[model samples]
Target: MTQKKSPQGGTFKKFIVVMVIILIIALGFTGLNYYLKYFGPNVTGKQEYLYIHTGASFNDVFKTIKDEGIVKDSTTFYWSAQNMNYVNRVKPGRYHLHEGMSNRKLINMLASGTQEPVTLSFHDLRQKEQFAGFVAKKIEPDSASIIHLLDSAAYLQQYGFTPDNVYTMFLPNSYQLYWNTTPEKFFKRMYANYEKFWTPARKAKAAAINLDPIKVSILASLVDAEALHDDEMPTIAGLYLNRLNKGMKLESDPTVIFAENDFTIHRVLTRYLSINSPYNTYLHTGLPPGPIMMPSVNAVNAVLDYQKNDYIYMCAKEDFSGYHNFATNIADHLANAHKYQQALNERNIKR
Candidate 1:
């Protein structure tokens, strides 16, 4: 049998061995390429965030990623995206980009729509327009869109608020929200938070003071403007409540300044009081129609738990301590006012 070994058989055996070796080499090369394209580091550069706008096409998204120079090799990313079917599954959102991210990881993230939430926060925003601007900076909606909603009486009315009092709905705090949240949705979320803040206990307190939640916020704005110290808020609130109970004018300098729309006026004058705006508490014998500024929670709570006192008038202290001198009678208030006026004159704050 050894002498009869067929030459054809040996040639066939050698061919099979050669084919096996070629197949092994081809598979090794293919696997290496696949590993490099899918699992290897693709994302590069210092850019840390990617904002894919709504209705963005896959091509548009890829262009943004490429333009940001976030990927080390565009060709590998393109290949991986095509193979992984991410080209058809692109999701629009704000994504957190990281350096040295693998193609597989990035592709998975983009397709899954797992976005990084933005931390939205604001404090002491003076105007509805200003609040809109703050929100626009963190979200996809422009300031104009948010402002339009804020000023829309019909739209605001659905939330049980007029355009003037609608600004009271937003409570100052940090909120985790998506960057692409619509204006209406944003307003609803803020209103929900406002509702949560005005709990049963808080509402009961507001009722005890003969003020509604919005009225409490309105008065809180005044208290916040008047008191330089948190400890003094209850006292200042008490004085305002006393005036309200007696049907006396608020006569708050802050409200006068608000009426004049002059935030720069540090020293409100008798001339400012002549501005016949409803916000001019000197002319209007009650709380203003709206908040002059977004009051803090502490200020709102202060109004709810206002101290009981008979203080009908208050004048700023002459010492510039940001504290006020309280008085129950006109004569005592006049004396304190005269001293404060003297201090103001010394400082040349005539306006």
Candidate 2:
């Protein structure tokens, strides 16, 4: 309608449209790239965990990732980590790797220190060294470090424990703890649990039995070693208490075995009783200086609620039924011992 469109103006309009299309394409590509980098799957399909040690540097973490092949694209992960500022916020812990996890999520977890806890359960551990080794397997501290603290008399004085008796503080149970917990913190947590377990009611029961909490635990260890059946715990505990009351030696075969540090002995021999160690109950009166093994809650409770009985002796039944024959006189105990010895001889279990 108007005058014929100017050629120059028409060309300028076409140029403007082409520029807009190019800009849109570039923007779209950039947005797609960013979305893929930030939100796309980066973790590998292999199910595994990342253990970042305490005091680990970001470089160490990155090296572990590369070595373990935890991520599909290391370049993208490194870029994402830098962008998220996770390089400086590295937290040591145990992190679970999920298949198809994005770098953003992984970085966020590591930065926030949202780590999975280790569920630690132990029982029948016989020595502090063994317990330390077992705990070290689940946590960050090495067995040597843990043993150092356990053996430190000055350090354990605050917790009312000695190197010999410290083993009693670790009650056998499942505990939830971070894998990066230090050795000192682990001991503190265990002491807190030990205190919690010795409630007012339990303390009162222990007092009634003329035993403090530590003594109760030491006796409980003996009870646990002697009784293979839980139902027999109270009776065995009662028998031991009777012997204690009579000022007689505990004469626990388990104590002798522990003194000799020979767990392979099926039948405790006469010679094993002569071991000069303080743990030899047949030679040393009262409970041993420490627990022969980690005491179970059942064993501890059995000691607290021991049956009132006059039985002062116990010998394993000859039937191999894991039960004991109780007696109030030496003659009856000798008879039971004879039967058990005969059974052992028949089985050729001399040790």
Candidate 3:
């Protein structure tokens, strides 16, 4: 009204205003779509982990995610992954899933190969097969693969280990490792840990006791098997060491059971002792060729720092209290053995 604008000018101004409003609406819609596709919550809370195995293709990963219902929207995740260049960066691992993770966050984690570690702990595993089976359950390698490496004499020679003695390298403790670790890497890590455990002081102690690290572990396995209670480990270790020093047989019942390869034998009989095997401590004068079982840290330390005692024989107490009666003379040892045998008879634990 102030300038007496023409009708044509007024029409042009309205058209321009309309066009600007349409452009603004379109821009806002695009922005919202972009945010939803990239930063919106996409991962679900149903799954705890998404295992992307090694040598998996992008298609495999996507299929697993969809099949496991790991993500809320498969299309949005694929879109975001493609746009963020994550499709070509597939990494294999055990990835931890969180509730309500954004597509960008999840994609970035996967692309960068950030994965959770597996906590592995083992103890008292009897044989390499059992150990391999237990470890196979924790890691990516199969039990057969692990056993192959454990039995490979040529491969173990590089580590200064044999098929028999290689079992000693795996110390019983909790370890942090990647779930996809190969069998070779597992052995390397275990050997490194074994080296760390056998410190200079421990080696000196072993040498002073006229035993090497491997021999200490072998003896420790016996001590670990014989002692039902931790407090009696040093005493049992000392008794065996005394026998070793005197050139007498170890005569360990556990060794006899091990030689027989029958763990169900509650009471080792005379026939079990006569089994012709190197592990039969009754027949073999020195320590067995290898550890009969995985020795505990306490058992290993007990062997290294054995108690000073003249006791050369040990028999389980007749009270079945998991303690032993130790003796230096054969007569007293026979009496202890007889009492224990009578107790076993009363309990009807034959064979």
lDDT of 3: 0.93
Question: What is the overall TM-score of model 2 with all chains considered together?
Answer: 0.97
Judge candidate 2 against the unseen true structure and give its global Cα lDDT, from 0 to 1: 0.93
| Total backbone collisions, model 3 | 0
Q: Is 1 or 3 the stronger prediction by lDDT?
A: 3
lDDT of each: 0.91, 0.93, 0.93
Superposed on all Cα atoms, the candidates' RMSDs to the truth, in angstroms, are 1.7, 1.3, 1.5
Question: Per-residue alpha-carbon lDDT of model 2 for 91-156, expressed as tens digits?
Answer: 999998898999999999999999999999999898988999999999999999999999999999
Which sections of candidate 2 miss by over 4 Å?
none
Q: Which lDDT tens digits does candidate 3 get at residues 97-148?
A: 9999999999999999999999999999999999999999998889999999
lDDT of 2 at 22: 95
Off by over 4 Å in 1: 1-12
Residue pairs clashing, model 2: none
